[model samples]
Target chain A: MSETVIKFGILGCAEIARKVGRAIGLAPNATIVAVGSRSAEKAAKYAADNGFPPATRAYGSYDAVLDDPEVDAVYVPLPTSLHAKWAVLAAQKKKHLLLEKPVAVNAAEFDKIVEACVANGVQFMDGTMWMHHPRTAKMKEFVSDERAFGKITAMHTCFTFAADPDFLENDIRVKPDLDGLGALGDAGWYCIRSILWANDYELPKTVTALRGPVLNKAGVILSCGASLYWEEGKVATFHCSFVSHLTMDITAVGTKGTLHVHDFVIPFQESEASFSVASESGFDELVTGWVPKPAEHLVNTSLPQEVLMVKEFSSLVGAIKAKGSQPEMKWPIISKKTQLVIDAVKLSIERGFEPVEVVG
Target chain B: MSETVIKFGILGCAEIARKVGRAIGLAPNATIVAVGSRSAEKAAKYAADNGFPPATRAYGSYDAVLDDPEVDAVYVPLPTSLHAKWAVLAAQKKKHLLLEKPVAVNAAEFDKIVEACVANGVQFMDGTMWMHHPRTAKMKEFVSDERAFGKITAMHTCFTFAADPDFLENDIRVKPDLDGLGALGDAGWYCIRSILWANDYELPKTVTALRGPVLNKAGVILSCGASLYWEEGKVATFHCSFVSHLTMDITAVGTKGTLHVHDFVIPFQESEASFSVASESGFDELVTGWVPKPAEHLVNTSLPQEVLMVKEFSSLVGAIKAKGSQPEMKWPIISKKTQLVIDAVKLSIERGFEPVEVVG
Candidate 1:
């Protein structure tokens, strides 16, 4: 079982890369071989500050990271607008990709990235760390249990952060040319992913943007919401904002069970996570209170969720390299599904809040 | 404070009547004086079965209870369609009214009932028991605190219960000629009230019903949701259904804080209720976990919420009778606000999911 570690080269010294760099240091099957930024000096400082091994290379450009013979994969944390260019180029250079999310500005752009990955046969995974958390698997089990959860009826999720004045004015997320999709893409990406995950990756039929979405002067969404409808009467709604307090939540209700997780995007603590579930809930005899109250389930993790995400991605890359196996399609498939719904929401918002049929 | 007690007269023996009847027994300032139904035999049995005092009268018709000289107030839990006629008649009889939720099918009917109560000098209060809960007041304090909660930006609430097959077909809530507003009127009533309550009863500028609402064969809404938008970019959404697992929740997000209550309509226990709040929350240095996690605040109640509702109503009635005070307008004002939003949602759904301006 002791295989060669998957060597990773970070594409940018973005703030998120600091966390993922620590994850790579913690992941047994992953190691950083190179770090890249627009300036080699900045890349070297990021690697030094983040405690990458002294032997690690600092590249002046992302192309140098992809060109390195020792780099088995690239972690793309570049601004969303540069995603298609670098992700496709990284794939074409025969390197696997672990891309930060809202994988592309739009689904079509993502499709092109996937096309390149398929052409080069490189593994693909988005940097949604919560998906790798052990607690998420436990939650998925509860929501999928027929006896415990029954048919899923509705779900609500939100991811919001109160951006400071500097962030609101100059952050890449609010810039039309950087993270062009804005809050609807950055914060909303997690909300959409959670909804799809709880629904067992089943895509809803339509997405309708709620009215009164706030936008910056550059026409980038600052806060927004959308409701998704499934033909079987299953509905899900999500809200994402850059102008609200830091709040991450997911509530999924089935015919017989309900699941709630307030820290779906980030756990309260690094070592433990918790969620509440109530099955076959009803009122007491006098209807004064619940008969069987919701029970909180705690999951303790040996490693943080981000570490697990890196480990999982490394294992997949190792499989392709050592076993000559096909790259895992599950991750990109889910990423595409999330992107499709986001595209639908964007279209719905553009169309004066009309219901846009989701193209799966 | 030791003035006369308010003697209550019950309407039909609907299932909810049993719960309120228990609350009346618990409230020191409220007493059951009469029980009324279509048949005298059923009324007598209901009174006996509920352990009513031997001195309490059993009336064959609702009119008899309204005319009872000893009955100072009426607890009208009749089907919604019967509310306009019987509630107005009771008000005209100078009987103070404690009406059940969705006080009438629509605001117009509710307005008529209010008019009758005003003309006859009778106190009017809808039986929204949660409003009287001590926990609700405690939660309100948190949401209202400018330092703790900040300006409210978004809110979401839901009330859903899985109805048995028989209830789906025969329950008064689903019957077109009876409690006809179905889930939107029954479960959704609580959702609307909670949203309005959190926002300090500031009506939303518009209400747009979500698509894919489930309806019964008789055109009664069985499942529905809507998004309410305020002009200042604040928004709220709610979902109600008769076919999902029982879940009552309220999540209010402000610029600096978030409030979450899992059991808003009914507490998990009679003596204790809890809610979670997080103020100025953010991630830790590594972004692996929350810095200041959400803190759970438990509020203990000496009496259940429904008992408090009865006590509050009876105390208001006592002030009117003993001090010749005018009726308190707060309860009716909130009820009217909730009903107005519901009417707007209904209208939006009728207009093919268009945004309906809420006329406060």
Candidate 2:
């Protein structure tokens, strides 16, 4: 009858971990039990600075947290290069895994991690925070209405942020040894996920990288884009970059309706998010203006999106721990699809922007 | 000295002619003097129904309007296939021409019209009404500021409308002999023009049509999209369809700022239009939301965009007529560039989505 609180272990203190750590503290069914880094002292300092519980332990390495019997879940915000290794080990150790976006460098590597999680019978989910936002649910509801929004015809998304000179030159994202996939993995992941989610998770028939992708001196992608085509005439295109002003946009057009969200990745306000929708819109007699103007719909959330994400992940972990339920396959399936598309885009770019068939 | 009103002759009784005739009436420097159609009765009915001035004349043939000495300028709102024939004739007859969009079936046909205008020293412009909106001037000013917007990184635009079953079956746009280019020339023209405008009128190096374009049984494009790449790494994309809800969007992202306009073709309100701008935007400490959120920029226009287009065209004619000045080359240059890109897209689609080098 007591509350089912899933104890989580914090990964290395990457910048994103600060936000996720705070989210863990805020999630009703989640608690941070330990912090891990290469140096035990650094882990202690990170836990103290990020307001982790006073009793939370500090570990000298990621393996220590995975070995701890008390840590039921591990939130892995480690560099993407380390994901395939650490994620598989975390699952083998019987710990629920909440991996970050771009779940792995590619889907081939992530398949091993998936196998480990299936073998251990532990819940697995990615850290795509926006998917848990209430606004996203509202948008999905509007798009699902058969009469209001008919079959989607096209969707376009872009997520870009201008990185400072120092970050552009020295950040892990731009360094070949660390998160080498760069902006495509960091920003384009959100764009691809949103596109697939809106398309009801239907993988594209072919992925073609757009021409003129920008890359750093070390061959790390700084800016890139790709177009996806489905068999039934649906098309989607996305652009991501570390060389543009912060802009996140998603425009979904259907036979009878259209949906637009300007701040899809991060809302302009934490408590409330809005999207514009126009159903069966047309022009006036003289075609001077729209007859029914698009209207904005606002959805308010009591908790921030990241906290909701943590809460959602923790609930699944709780079900496995307390009720002996099977691991949910939805999150892992979505994560794999996103990674597959990413891999296809990378291949298309590698093959001179040719179309690459997306493998199931 | 009293008033340099450019006496305008409308070349057809098409649905669009009604709007342009009304615009001619509203423009202070323009006046509808005559309307011409295959049937004189239909032309008269169109003129009366559209509120043309009482003294306006109706003619039994398009040639009659071009032959009238009082008609200093002619507004040709005929089908795209008929444009090359009538527009060049109007120019050869010494009438300044305001031709409808997709000025001709392709760039080759439009080039002949341009030649005719040049030979006769006649001012020429296309009927892309939104280009004359005051809001466009404001958008240009914002993107022109290098410090605020930096180098433009990417531009994406779409213009789509759902056609009724009747229109899908019988509309001139869906007919191969009338408007063979279909949605690409109708809706996609605006998208391509908008991209070129935002990119400071520089044409892309190559144009590649996206895969899976929808075509009608008669081989007219019903829905299509293309990606354009510049040599300097600037990329642009556009989609146009007659099978989707009415949606017009333009997202222009630069290194330092982003600009978004949902209703770029037609404003929601005739009197006011607005766009969102975010300059140097970033996230807060927790990355929960934007720090300096995108701001909406409202632009007011006392006159409708169509009326402004008519007035601007009239002013150019008046200058040429009153001072014996040579025709302003800007409008014709823009029209040619737009038509060239349209030709490239059609070629790319025909060549199995191959990248076609854009010809100047």
| Candidate 1 CAPRI assessment class | high
* Candidate 2 C-alpha lDDT tens digits along B204-230: 999999997999999999999999999
Off by over 4 Å in 1: none
lDDT tens string, model 1, A205-284? 89999988999999999999999999867899999999999989999999999999999988999899999999999987
In order of appearance, the predictions have TM-scores of 0.99, 0.99
Q: Native contact fraction of candidate 2?
A: 0.81
Task: Supply candidate 1's per-residue lDDT for A279.
Answer: 98
Which digits, one per residue and each the tens of the lDDT, describe model 1 over residues B332-356? 8999999999899889989999999
lDDT of 1: 0.93
Could you tell me the interface RMSD of model 2? 0.9
Q: Lowest lDDT 10-mer window, candidate 2 chain B?
A: B1-10
